[model samples]
Target: MLTTDSNKATEIRQAAAKHHGLPLLPRPTDDERDPLRWPRSLKLAALIATAFVNFTANFAGAGLSVASPVLQAQFHKTPNQVNSLLTFNFLLLGVGNLFWVPLGVKFGKRASLLISTLILFAVLVWTAKETAFAGLLAARCLSGFASAAGESIVPSIVTDIFFLHEHAAMMSWYTILVSSATAIGPLVASFIVQYSRGGWVDYVWVCAALAGANTVAIYFLYPESNFNRPKEPLHRVSVTGEDADKVQVVKTETISRHRVSVVSKSWFSIWTSVFTINREINILEVALRPLKMLLRPSVLLATFIYGTSLASQIILIFAFPSLLLAPPYLFSSSQVGLMQIAAIIGFSIGCFAGGYIADIITAVVIRRQTGNVYPEQRLVALIPGCLVAPAGCILIAFACSDKLHWVAIAFGFGMVSFGTIYAPNIAITYVVECYPRVVAECLVAINVFKNLVAFLFLYTAVDWVASSGWTQVYMIMFMLVSLSMLLAIPFYFFGPKWRGQVDISNVSEE
Candidate 1:
């Protein structure tokens, strides 16, 4: 039988080890032993929240073409100058994750979310009041910064709340919300601007209004999902002091004992029943994680593959309408916005189902690979999308090259929308699944790299399309899209093996 004193000593040593940060894995508990499935209501709520957040974040980016002139007229700037708002948003959104993700570990997901959501609301409200060009720019920059906290950690939130099986589809739904907003936000912005003499300001104010409304809704419904409880030592022992030697060991045990004692001693709980201690200072490590993730080979390669593709996607959305509508095409701005409906229809359902398809591929791959689910499983979803996007680019390119039937152009656009949305959804799912612990890191790095590329291409996209005509510009698109698809195979096949090679921190803690 274990004596009371030896049992207490064992407990002390275990606590010390945890404080020193040498955790093996998240221990399974009766509460957590609940089968790895989400409650139906909770799952639906998460999906809805993710979709809503995505839509709001993308509200302006989706229809910048329509909003561009309103901005140009108000600020007396060129199209490139107008598009800079998004460039700022992307930079802040990418880097803000670095700041907010750490909060998830220290304060838990709900509190972190509340803080971010509130800040987003306040910034948007303040943005609505800015009238001068510089004022508007400053407001937007801060709004973008405030918005980052929510956007950066959402994938982590999804992972925290949902199980493995639901991830692909849930992520897809989130993507759908994002893509749809891009497809629809401008359409809405255009109509709103047309009616309101205030024009571009109306669009910003409306978005601000929406953000404010969402803040209240989020606070009540969001659940705590840190999942990790404060660890306490509960070591098993014999009545004799035999295990005493284990705790007394100079090198390892000494380190462990000091750590646990420090943390345990520092812990001052409101009640003995408290199972969580706030580790506030360690938060800086969390904030800088996404920056460190770029050093990882998997994140770097995957970011290149996915980031460039996304940059192209954004460039197409922002630049293509003006190219097609402005002179010889002679289509009105409204007609251009209408053209997006074809793409929007495809992007919405295409994204939702793409997740299910990714899940299916992962399941099939798992069965074939001795019941193991690999990061590569997520890549299979890209296969069809990858091939389809290039083909769409070819058809669209050829059609634009010839100024062929508008119907031909629309058909190709439909395919492009479907293919583009699907492939990235796959990439997002793969990254989240592969680096579940450091998910916040991978997500933000990809966005930063993606947006940086987007900022660069956006500058040249107008000039390139203007000088070369749509067909040649699209030929480049076909090549880029085709290459992206072809590259998916080896990554999906070889990526799994590599994902296993990296040491992801905090999975053991989760």
Candidate 2:
């Protein structure tokens, strides 16, 4: 009996060691035993708050576009100069990622969100009230900075609060909210400008009101999600006299320890939580880590893929209005805004196709491969989008060159929108799965590269298309999109091998 007992003890220790030492995998805590025990109502509320934040911020970004003509008249600037508002906004949006994610990682996600939302509300007010062109431009720059939390910080919150099986689906919902704003903002802006005596400022007022309401909701509903997982192994001997021989590691009550209970906190306590600062942050390290992510091969590849897709989207946003408003199409401002409805539908399709399908692929691949889910599993979903997106570009080019019916152009736009959401969603999901330790930093790097590329292309997009005509410019864009998509072929084939080279054991403590 003693010899058998000794052997059993050895086996248990080995099992514990196996779990504790795996760096790529999250350390198993009580939270893993029953993942469904997370507070359903609070989780739903939090998810809604984050989604609203994403919508409000993105709405502000797109809202300015429909009013470009009015802006040009008021500011006495050329079309190019007017578009620079977005240039500044996109540039800072990327740069702001570096700042905001680190703040969330250090200070706390809820606190960072509240602060960012307040800043966004203030900037929108300033944008609405400012009469000078320079003041308006400055407000836009600041608004981009303020709104960075939605893109960089909110996704991390999603990852922090949800399970692996849930990440893709939840992310899809988040993306839907963000993408809908592009279409919805223009609709709101066009109608508000059309009817309101307040004119262009009415759009800003609406955004500000939505943002202010969201800010209040976040303050009351959003709780901190950055719970530090206990390092101790969960398979310890039970202290109960009746169950001395048994291990009770999977109890739902034990899992509750991993969450911070705030249902009972008073108003003052909730308000004061925002002022709490984390002392563990090394400012220099936080600033440099995202830049360092660029050196990782997998990260770099993902960056390029996401960046190319983003640049294409920005190009389409700027170019489509100019194209439709001129010559054969002659679409009104309201009509052009309505055109985004097709893209909105496409994005909705892409979100469901790419996001949930990704989770299914991971499960299928893992089942096929002896129940092991590799990082490369995420790459399979990219192929469908990769092939389809460029086809959309081709369709758009031909339709524009020949002046086909508006529906042809709309269909092409839909395809591009679908691919944009589908491919980038897979890329980001793969990165997080592969490098769970440094998600915040890796995302910051991705955002930086994506925004920089967007700014460069957007600044010159109008001029290039005007000079070369729609067909030629779009053909060139098609080639660029194709090349970026082709780059993924290598990643799909060799991604597992490349991920194997990464020492995920040296994971970020943050």
Candidate 3:
């Protein structure tokens, strides 16, 4: 038993080692089953699997962009109608979060992921075989629905397995895969369509193959990361003696066994466990919780910022074919695909700036604050991103309007990509840190907003650019991106107070 003495408890707490100058948050328990206590290798493997699924999801959604010309000619459709292939997919990707995340909450992240991966594999195969425009559209929409698991559940998994100190770094890794996949997918697809005899359909087949492999990998690599951990103190301290000199401190927390059992279960049993739904969870409430979360200002602001940034990327992707293929540039499909290299370069830098550098800055802030940790402390990382992303938009606008060098346009795309990674990484991470108890719902809300914004912008991208011209449209984008990134400043100062005012007890209650 632990003593209830306040002075001794305080002394023992002071004696404990600190993690980046702060105590471990949502403290891990003595229970070996707690995900936070899992082996480093296991934790990393799970994260890689989750991130790969995210990569595959985005790759499938955007890879077809490079093939737009081929697709338009094949389907005998207008540009806007053709763009619907990607736009509708984006819409369902957001809407699907509403469905899959609730199911993940009820069934298990691992289980939900497995089911979604299987569905994604089937849809990819269907997409490869579809000959008609409507068939391809339906197939792509289903793929988006299946892909939502990557967007919504991944952040929750990161929270489950990683400490607060590790969140930014881990999320950066996930975001790199996601953002890079979007950029790289087109690069790969452009080459495939340009060189392959099957043209655009070859890209769909490749995605299907990857999705099939991903399903098998998920089965083996991703176990149930969702552990219902009990709330406990950071550590329990007991003073064994009354004498100041003679007192002994006993640390009570111990791992009796490793979290993972070595005994192997039958494949069927594992499958059944993954599919089993938890009766205790309220399905309806889980589904509606994300919608309810939108009422919170922090949630809305974070989602809006993230949504607009993502939409900017979508619009750029939609416009690329039209601008590069038809303009004075008259670039080949392969050349257009290579343009993504610039975005990838930006993603690489942003990943380092947003993830590792942000983590370092956050630790410094915590130390300076005398070990006090706040969610807003992480916002400092967004400063560079806020400035860079909007500038990138302006550069792109000018490059297009003046018919500047292709390198200038590529550089602008790179800048916007940098901002996309930098700002949203902080925004989404901040929301999760603020509402640790309701991470899934918060992520669902962000994804819904992100996809909705992307869907609307992308659906109208062709006509919007055609009617307004690139300069006017991108200038408007510059304003929207700048305003959204700037909003973080106010939130950084007053977010804590505002967060306190919101009531999430009802939604988070078991």
Q: List per-prediction Cα lDDT, in the order shown.
A: 0.62, 0.72, 0.79
Cα RMSDs, all models: 11.8, 7.9, 6.1
Q: Model 1, stretches more than 4 Å misplaced?
A: 1-29, 32-38, 229-277, 500-510
Prediction 1 TM-score vs. true? 0.78
Candidate 3 lDDT, 466-489, residue by residue in tens: 899989988988899989877878
As a whole number from 0 to 100, the lDDT of residue 448 in candidate 3 is 90
**Can you write out model 1's per-residue Cα lDDT over 1-510, one digit (the tens) per residue?**
569756666665565333221221122234542212335465466557544765776774454557776778778998777777766766666566666667766776556656676777777777667778777677767766666665556666677655555577777776677667766877777677666777766777788776766565555444454554334232212122234323221122333323211111111221122123356436666666677677765676656655555554565667756756655677656666676777787786577657776776655544444334456666766655566667777787777767776678777777777765787777777777667767767787876676566566665776677688777877787787677667776776677565544443443311
Ranking by lDDT: 3, 2, 1
How much lDDT does candidate 3 score? 0.79
Question: What lDDT score goes with residue 324 in model 1?
Answer: 62
Per-residue CA lDDT of model 2 for 261-372, tens digit only, reads 3333334644556644657666567767788777776778778777777676667777777888888999888888888888888888889888877766654444344334
lDDT of 1 at 311: 56
- Full candidate order by TM-score, most accurate first: 3, 2, 1
